[model samples]
Target: MEPSSILVIYVTRIGDTMLVTPAVRALAQAWPKARIDFFGSRTSAAVFRHLPFVSRVGVLTKKRIRFKGWLQRKSYDLALVYGFDGDGPFVEYALRVSRQVIAFKQRKESLNQKLLASIDKTTIRCSNSVDYLFSLIAPLGIPKAGLHLSYVISESERQWAVARLAALRDGGAGPIVGLQIASFPTKGYRDWPVENFVELCRRIRSEHPKAHFLILGGKREWKRTRALHVSLSGCSTHYAGRLSLRQTAALMGQLDLYIGVDTGPTHIMGALHRPMVALYHPSSPSRALAPLEHPCCHVVDHPLADRGATEHTPMAGITVDAVWEKVRAALSGEFPPPLVTPWTP
Candidate 1:
């Protein structure tokens, strides 16, 4: 069926929302004239507004009757449910409003297995989130668009970033290195040690002598960012909790290199196609969500990630020295081999 209108749902965080770009692009390319609507949270919807392919971005906060009335008014021809946040009223509403609903099974029970059997079957799986999403939409006959991640930064936003960075630029400051010190609380295991970040910044600057650092994260990370600021002092600019997401992205686009844990901002930086060193722990494997298609996205997984780690893997295993090697390679437009183990350097 050639659907005239389509609705897609994925209310996850920035990283999860960003991974759907290739799939979204695939839909747009396959049906150039189809109006694509995205159902996500405010932040996630904000991310989609930048994509020209998106016609409307809706949030599912209160689920008021008015909201339901408005959504029902749209009379969407088809609904595509993404992996996370695909349950509750949204799913029920998708089933109600759209002619066809395509979603993955949310449970392992017989009921869900049978429910999913009635829909299209997902025949492929991949460690990479981008590919994982493409598989969900494969039944629509949209092939993999490309591995590249995309974001739209407005001109005003670019100006804001330039102005913000200008004040921090010293007469002799070396390259600008962006650092994301913490991850979301629920995924704290993915965070690299703050002391490691402080030490890594010190060591990198020691080599560059006058390098500058920009610390990036959400407001929840103020404590860590504050502590890191105290340690690095004048050498770094703390933007966590201070700027909007797009503004932070705008600033990130101007950075020479980014060093950070596996977090949403890291994904945003990747979509901006900036050079970066993205860290990961066994809590979440790097392959599943590492920056895709970025020319210089270097992922440094904790050594414990591969060595049969069952419990949470600590960030302590990813040494400053090990990450520094990848940082050096990334800054030089090169990449260290697949896994950045301590023995690599």
Candidate 2:
């Protein structure tokens, strides 16, 4: 069956939204002529911009779901909804706007019966999050296109990034490292200690001498990032609360290396194919969440990664020396050869 118009709805956090790109890419590859539209959270919606295959991106919220598609015709030939609970408003909205709808099995048996195909949420077929999300389209028989996350940085944004980096460097040639110090409040256990970062930066600068750092995060992390900036004094720039999500990503593209806790920007950096050392907490280990088929990714997993640690597990188990070794290897161009061929759109 040929689907001329498609709608994909996934309203979630920034990192989770990035995780869905592989599945979306597979859909585009299978239906090259289809016009695809995306619905995401206001912040996560920015990720869909600059993608060649996406025709439009709109914001979606549970609050705005009431009467949303009641006034319109069923405009989409196929629709897919992700991360919605059983018989939720998001599922109802998708049913109203599309000829065929696919989603995870809802709580109510009646709602599950309504979907074109309802995926069993507990099937446990995939080891990683990207592959798990891709399962939503398995009933459609679309071949997997790629497993790596997707992000497009435009030429203008690239230029802006370059210019910003130049200004920050001020003619001094040094390895520019970007750092994300904290995760969101709920995922605080995923964050490595800020003092560990300070010690790591000190070690990196001692070896490279000319190395510089870019402190990156949202306003919630401002106090800690500020302290690190103050400790680094002349060598680091604080960008924690200053830029929008896209702007932060643009600057991240210009970095020589990125060292971060597993978070949204780490996910963005994963898509850029740049040198990076990502620290993962045991609760959400690198095997499950790290970028797949990435050429330069260096993962530092916590000691308890295989021990079935809970969210209460501290990320400090991933030491400064462990992360520093990866950082050093990345800076020296000692990355292992690509294990798998990188997927292209």
Candidate 3:
């Protein structure tokens, strides 16, 4: 494979971008010599740093910014874009700049039609967003199974995380468990009750006397994390909203295990191949988002065991007992095989 110039665009939040890694890896493996460039939102750009196959990363700001004119000026050989109608401008950018453009073939909505008109190939019914983009490279004979996930952490980041943990623990424990208690509050039903977490931590400590728990989450989740810590009464250390995204990722890598809701940090842990117990509610697409490529990951689904008349919601039905069972299973080392190879690119 010659080093053809290629541009890949995926503009989504942290978790969505992380999901794209497997597809990225597939392209890189299939075209080892290609100069692969990635474009994503500023927040997601950090996730792509140090990725092996990425020669460069372009940060797309807001929405509808033109990287196409820039890439067109540079004359890249290939361009791939993810997202639906809202992403048409990106497809247009790819079409204008690269010799070949490949995009998802969604409903022939005007936006998709417009994007399709600009691109050379559009794939419909590629359900997995990442897989959809990777399939475009089939013309180059890249095998579908070649896709995998990759994320590189700096040695400094790892050291920084270890030191931070050491400082927090004050040499009390040798290994810590990472716990993230809350997902976004809007989807509050997705959250397992904080009391359940307190109970889980108590049991874990009883089973492994020397092990401590480290709570991680965003600022909005800080209060819940603190409450859980208080309930544990020194059995756990709260580090919620305190670390940068990458730092948190590095911290997660150092932990013996991770327990969290269907959230971004869990997805990051998934990328690192860290063992995890992910809690999911009917609100989340657990089958879609749970760690796909890592073998040591576990998922707990609780679809609101009871619902009153005239009330319906995805996560509101999940129960704590179901979550505990999944967590216990993960601790016992019974985990599912990754649904897909880690996405790399």
Give a tens-digit lDDT track for model 3, residues 1-345.
443888888887777778778777777766787889998887688899888778998787545575437633647777777766553676667666777766765454553554423333343344344554555555455554443356788899989887877764686684578998887666566677788788777777767787788889889987898899898776677789887888888889888789888777777887788778887665345555666657787777654422232223544344556666676677677887677633322
In order, candidate lDDTs are 0.75, 0.88, 0.70
Error of 2 at 311 (Å): 1.4
Model 1 Cα lDDT, one tens digit per residue, 1-345:
778898888867888888788788878878888998998877888788768888988886535512474445538777887763334455556666677766766543432442322233354545677777776676676555666677889888888888777765757676899888888898887777898888888878777878898888888989989999889988887888998888888988889888888888888877887788888877577877786666677888778775787547678987888998888888678964432111100
Write down the lDDT that model 3 would get: 0.70
For model 3, where is the 10-residue window of minimal lDDT? 303-312
lDDT of 2 by residue, 1-345 (tens): 889999999989889999999899889999999999999899779987887879899998888886699999999999999996545788889999999999988887777788999888888466678878888988888887778889999899999889988865786858999999999988988988889999999999999888899999999998889999999999998999999888899999999999999999999998999999899999888878898878898988999997989999888888888998899999998786543323222
Whole-model lDDT, candidate 1? 0.75
Q: Candidate 3: which stretches are off by over 4 Å?
A: 1-3, 63-74, 85-87, 105-141, 145-148, 167-170, 303-317, 332-345
**Count of residue pairs whose backbone atoms collide, per candidate:** 1, 0, 24
Model 1 bad stretches (over 4 Å): 62-67, 70-74, 84-87, 106-124, 336-345
